[model samples]
Target: MSTHRIRFLAALAGLLLLGAGGNAAAQSTITCESRNGQYQSCSANTSGGVTLSRQLSSQGCWQGDTWGYDRNRVWVTRGCRAEFRVGGASSSNNTGAKVAGALVLGAIVAAAVANNKHNDHDDRYDNDYDNGYGGGYGNGREIRCESTSGRYTTCGYVDRHQHVEIRRQLSNQQCVYGRNWGVDGRQLWVDDGCRAVFVVY
Candidate 1:
């Protein structure tokens, strides 16, 4: 080949290599850990950046740092857990294992917290339920209903709302309500009169 033609081919090859390197650099894996470092979870192979949130309810409680990943700070509650998300690239290498580890770690942490609370006789932390309804309430609108008599009360749902649902009961009195709660697309009803906080997902 002529010298000019050879130079052109070499430049093309270099460009291709550079492109490949760029792709590789853009790839990244996502991992999650409880604030206390008692639990760690990682996502499948992914590129770019990952967004993580704490598992909602009993799975674990975590709050993400307001800042970006560089300043990532996860505030874990007594029963804290973590979640990971892969971004950019799509690969599931060893993801199942990572996820399983995360779940196991979460269970361990939750159990530890429960045991501690039980020993301490902490009524405030007791009776908390995690319905496995997913992450925080998100941007959904909040609807609240209060009952003073601890009697069954209903918090009717509004229209145009859909998805997962969760309820929180707050009471100043040390009363326990039976598990006679029910939820529909439009409303949530509690059989007892406890201040109910409902979030429609």
Candidate 2:
């Protein structure tokens, strides 16, 4: 081989060995405690640089009232290292609060059931009829009536210059009047006393 070619090959071999050694050094590994009863592992690969492998193992036995940090995992990179610790006790307190809330909810449900049962037993001897009718009265000159039953009609009386409302019943209908009917011609009028009516027809 020529002397220059031999020299170039030897220099190339030296450069390759240096590159391999640098790669190996870049690929560093570290281990730490996970603190959560589990192992955490990570690996990193880099171009023309070292890769990193990290493992974290822990034996969870730390406690705090409101917040705290316990020995967990520690990870180290080429330029940076970090220690991960638990500092939040809010989760444990929240869990206990949730348990208490559940118990209270259960007690409330039990009380409601007991109250319902007691009412059911007490109402057995009551003579009051349950017509399921909701009713109220109004003192205004206007009166309104509504019914879920389509067979019945509602009516009201009024004097002249006064307003009257009459609701009709369905099916065969009839009307009977015992007094003289007095009413002015209907006209559009708006006032605070205006009555509202809703009809299915």
Candidate 3:
């Protein structure tokens, strides 16, 4: 074969390998549903980052992101039907449907690996949640606690309507409320008083 022809063939092979790798790195997604076709709250796991989309605007949906999982909750204040897409990848070059499709792909790969190691634990968990077992991590709430003198501050995940109490006295300071609730539904502040309790829904 001619030198130029051989060089062309080698370049083509490299390009093919690169394209295959790119496809394998693409994201995956999964659709999540509530139990009994009705649920006050629910959650699901994912391989990568997660973003939520509602089937209908009437069905209000809320989500929280954590390591290796995405927690989703729905309220009846609007509607009852919704779904979640998991394993989304963050990319600066893509937008809209392309990004979503990649996420779905990633989720599928992750689920397969997890199933092999744990005997389909992921499937069982989803089944239990769908069947009304109330399976999930946090209660879809965030809590932040601070000391009276503003010397100490702590924040963590809390369940819905979960009561959080912090007791710490700096001198003779009483608990002073800074902000009852955060605009994003996940904040608690205390100043002056040594102890405070916050109920997050």
Candidate 4:
């Protein structure tokens, strides 16, 4: 072969070797899958950063939403199945944050569950309290009655035995009690008018 061709082949072989070494050095494969639509964490050397090298499922593999890496493991959620090229840990170091983050995530989930149970208990207590006090006089409530286009408008519920009065007038139209505005059974009515806030006691 020609001398020029021999030199060219040698350079090409050197370039190929360097590329192979680079891939073998930092790039390796790890698969993380979200099973049954649940979050799954797979062990990996994640430090420099992780990139989704390939998606292995029909579900979309989105970063920060479906798949993400913290310090030492790759986590996947929402049925995202993908193969990741773990650049391994960065040259800086791994500070064992993976375990810490996992613990924190567990705590957050537990707190949320506890809070939901507490709220449910409070809701039940409120219902029981309401049932226990049937037809009792409640605190004074504010009712806003607005007259739109000179038409009568009714605002909130009014107890038949409760007293209601105009607390604040929101319109230029004068709200004359017993004339332009009054209570009808359980509702406050307004006529010929503007809007006004009422305090129903």
Candidate 5:
């Protein structure tokens, strides 16, 4: 009800917005996997499926571990494994187990949301790239082409389903988005839709 209190609330709201924005701007993500079973070896695999052999050292109050991998199974060789002794739960309330379970669930949800957002952004980029050069426009059924300096540029003559092309422009690099590929060859800008997608060499 007071002016001072109102200002304090406003400042708190701004800080919360700033924190969310900072988190959204982070382009990196965290991925974690834990498995306990009959494993012969251990390794950490990236989300892209590449495996890393180096053991990750745990920080904070957590225990450290090493891992190994075998033909069929990946194993955690040295790490903390929580096991419940027989009749122990009846004697103890298992407070530590409950807290650890909550933490693990939180981590899983965070990872899932981050991964979804990253994939959504990538898809949007692909859509924009497709829409920008998909079809022809203007008075001609075909896309308009013009020579700029030495290279040629193409523009759509109509909306939707129109295609454009450029020639003689030097494209030293190629960009790949989702299943879509853009070729910046020495010729002109070529929009091949999702076909002819370039892969990282």
Candidate 6:
């Protein structure tokens, strides 16, 4: 099985345990919290069973929405902060659906990857956001991306996971990587009066 499939199965195992409600007075609990809107995991005996006992954040603690568990730990994301009750009986014989579910998920992931690759070329746009050099990154056309007056501005579309390298610098303001300019989400951003022509592969 692929790594993604294995991870999906392990997380599913924890969701199943939540449904198998056992002891209400389970003597164990642990607090899991998401720090600054980032996902966080906390150690707990989640195999026993898990339930959200109390919420510490204004973000609602909805099961499988803001919080989830695996066999070993409970995770919180999207500013969720909560104490989870653990220590109910671990459910066995629930492996029947795990493999089937993973197969379906693997297919979905593969299809998404294929679709993204097919349309990636057309996704980049040449907007008036920067002086026109052209929007073609791999088509041998260069786009002029610049930050004006030390203000941050988006230049062009570049995938958050895609690598962008400076093909040529147009500014004397030092187009240093990650400081004066960088890719943020699906757009390239420039800051601190940095200007450059970027290429993405």
Model 6 per-residue lDDT tens digits across residues 42-93: 8877656788898999976666545778888788776889988888554354
Taken over the whole model, the C-alpha lDDT of each candidate is 0.43, 0.30, 0.40, 0.66, 0.31, 0.67
Cα-lDDT of candidate 3: 0.40
> Against the true structure, whose lDDT is highest?
6
Report the lDDT tens digits of candidate 4 across residue range 1-201. 344654555555455444434433367888888888566889887765788988998987767556777778888876789999887443322223334444544555555556564554435434433544212335545666799999978877754445666789998989765446765546678888868988755
For residues 1-201, could you state the per-residue lDDT of candidate 3 as single tens digits? 344654554555455444444533354444444334332334444444455554433433444211113234222211334454554343434344344545545554555555564563446544544554333433422334545445544444443333344333333555433222111233343433344444343
Cα RMSDs, all models: 20.3, 36.9, 19.1, 27.7, 19.7, 12.9
lDDT of 4 at 150: 92
The C-alpha TM-scores of every prediction are 0.26, 0.15, 0.25, 0.34, 0.15, 0.34
Q: Residue-wise lDDT of candidate 5 within 1-201, one digit each (tens)?
A: 344654555555455444433423112222223333211232322222223323333411121122223333233322312211111011123334444555544555555566564554435434544555332223322222233343424332232222223322233333221111222222223233212211111
Local distance difference test, candidate 6:
0.67
In model 6, the Cα lDDT at residue 26 comes to 55
Off by over 4 Å in 2: 1-90, 118-201
Over 4 Å off in model 5, which ranges? Answer: 1-25, 37-201
lDDT of 3 at 188: 43
- Tens-digit per-residue lDDT, 1-201, candidate 2: 344654555555455444433423222333333333222323332222222232232222121110112233222321222232222122232444445545544555555566564554544212221221111222223334322333233333322222233344221322211011111122211122222331210
Worst 10 residues of 4 by lDDT: 90-99
Candidate 4 TM-score to native: 0.34
Candidate 6 worst ten-residue window by lDDT: 126-135
After TM-score superposition, the amount by which residue 114's alpha carbon in candidate 2 deviates from its true location, in angstroms, is 0.7
Error of 1 at 50 (Å): 29
* lDDT (Cα, tens digit) per residue for candidate 1, span 1-201: 344654554555455444444533343333344443232333344334555543533443322211123223222322344454444542345344445555544555555556563566533212222332222335554557666566766776543224323456565543222233444334555554556566655
Model 3's TM-score against the true structure: 0.25
lDDT, candidate 1, at 15: 56
